[model samples]
Target: MTITHRFLQIAAVAMLLGGCTSKPIYNAQENFSSNMGISENQMQRAIVTALHDRQWKIQSVKPGQIEAEITVRGRHHAEVDIPYSPTSFEIRYRSSWGLDYKNGEIHGNYNRWVNRLRDNVLKELSIDPNIEALNNLGAVKRDVESPSYFAFQEGVERATQAGLLDGSIQFYLSGQPVPGSAHHIRTVTSSRKTNGANKSDKDACIWALQSALVALQSAAKKAGANAVIDIASIDQRSLYKDANNYQCNAGTFMASVALRGELVTLK
Candidate 1:
């Protein structure tokens, strides 16, 4: 494990200990100097897009503000209000259920969800296109359970159902033979995230893996390749090659999968 991941794991353990007594309530009122020149309508659209992408249901909408809520795995729920102008927006925590809220403190996952909302808003506004980097900036805290791993096929069905992968584009993992005469097109990496609130680690990992597969599939299609071969986990720059399984890191709020593979066309 990288130092950063190790540090996050240690910090999560500390947070768990603190949670035995009281955690902290999270509220965000962010000012965006960078988006000053944008219009109020644009700000609203950005916020709405971010909210939708994160699966937050819009409760109410008006001229300068909106109320939204999310229920995770039919268990945890959170509500927040976004009051925005052309200059900035705020994600103020409203209420929650099934998250151990008491004496002004709530579950750590609440903060992560809100923070991710904030970052996604920034992403919708910013010109930078590195989503993984933005996600990294937002989800700094780790879950009590920091990491999880799973088999390659464990996520394949879900990925196929989600239209992220298909038999048209085959995925050959490391040490798995590439059938037919295949010409390598390029090597690419995909990193993807899935919300982990109240979800099983395996399920979250699979969702994330599905997204990563989609990214690779997109790249392969773009390069006119029919397959992605020699896939391996390259999280934090360390390679974990396997013919069957891949690696995923699951925390309280998010699960992430990063994969590298060579795009190839079988002739």
Candidate 2:
């Protein structure tokens, strides 16, 4: 073969390889299955709770099916369809935004969220134990309050007081202003975590944001400020961590989100 032809052939092969590597492999459909031996009514309740806990709004519901929507900071949004029976259920992806997608693949985040939902559903289903012995034990404890229980309660109060001293704060997203005019305070940030075993990614995101808000509010209060203002750029710090940022990570049975934002006062 001519040298020119040989070079052209090599270039074509390289181009083909590049195209293949540029696209990631993803599943066209993602689903989760659970068999908790719960009644249909109970299962539906659990499903709703799982979605609500993650900030998902239930758009519609009927026998053996649920439709929900998830919107992240008015940016990324997703629709999820869940169908279940008396003893089993499945969470399936319907659509999404701000995520990688192709004919058959979706961004990994979608799968993570679904998995978290499944875990939460199972947790809710297990809340009502069917074991007679466990039920009896719980009943006895409820009937007979112990002295140590009061002491434990006191300890909880002390812990709460300590948390307040840690300088926690509340924050508002952009456009969600405090009641009246407020001054602009320094930007503040905070974060929280969930093990993904008992909590979903949505729950982790909420907790992280809540923690950050608490810290921000605490700082503002110390500054004699009543509320924060112009809160913007709410997000998850999937790659980098900083003082004013939000991010989430997931593993087999672990998930966490870090949140950060500017602290401003409403004047």
Candidate 3:
């Protein structure tokens, strides 16, 4: 028979085996801004983080909604619509593949995935991104590489392995030396969100710096430049020039780092 008929037959057999069933669609309300006084932006961030943690790819984002899709093991796929407000949000079923959805019924696994996503969102919303929490956790560097700190060399190595960057490109701070003969291309800035949820400020700052370096290298390559020079921290529009360290804002859920540098070609 046709592929469609074959699929339907398989689904019918699966249904007969009780692997699929009808379930009420999940809708979450009061998931935000009750006693916490969170804004819509904060609610959006939490939801985004939760989705990322749950391996959901955001398909599109609108002012009041986010469309996301999740693929399980390159076979089953599910899509969801999340329309949110400062006071509430709802997760509605949009579509699915390999789930045998019919007449408002679907494989029981779909319900379980939605339920897990809801639980993660709730947990993320309840977390306090307070800087103090990270500070109290102590331990200065050493012992083990903190998940927060981004080692520069390690970052470079990773980029090289991924074929995105090379060691031939030089990176320098504002006070570092660049060959006087090098031709300046254009100045560029790279900013990245830091993982500040449960990381220490110092570690988060390091990670942000590493992330910025990778961006700069990518930009330089795109511009046919061999180096990024005169790097300066311009986070929040406040410029800080340091030879050995960059500036980072680490606290709460919004840790970030921004670096500006001149892209140049060396002889």
- The whole-model lDDT of each prediction reads 0.78, 0.52, 0.69
Cα-lDDT of candidate 3? 0.69
Which stretches of model 2 miss by more than 4 angstroms? 1-37, 127-267
Expressed as tens digits, the lDDT of each residue in 26-89 for candidate 2 is 2222222332224688779989998888778999999999999887777667787888877567
TM-score of structure candidate 3: 0.42
TM-score of each: 0.48, 0.37, 0.42
> What local lDDT score does residue 188 receive in model 3, on the 0 to 100 scale?
75
Would you list the rank order by lDDT, best first?
1, 3, 2
Per-residue lDDT value at 172 in model 1 = 84
lDDT of 1: 0.78
On lDDT, the stronger of 1 and 3 is 1
Clashes by residue pair, model 1: none
Provide the clashing-pair count of each candidate structure. 0, 18, 2
- lDDT assessment of candidate 2: 0.52
Query: Over the stretch 1-267, how does candidate 1's per-residue lDDT look in tens digits?
Result: 999999999999997886775458767765645313457887899899999999999999898999999999999999988999877789988888988888888888888898888878866654222434534554612534444668897687778877667768888889997778989886677878788898888888888888888888888889999998988775442467889899887776777787777889998
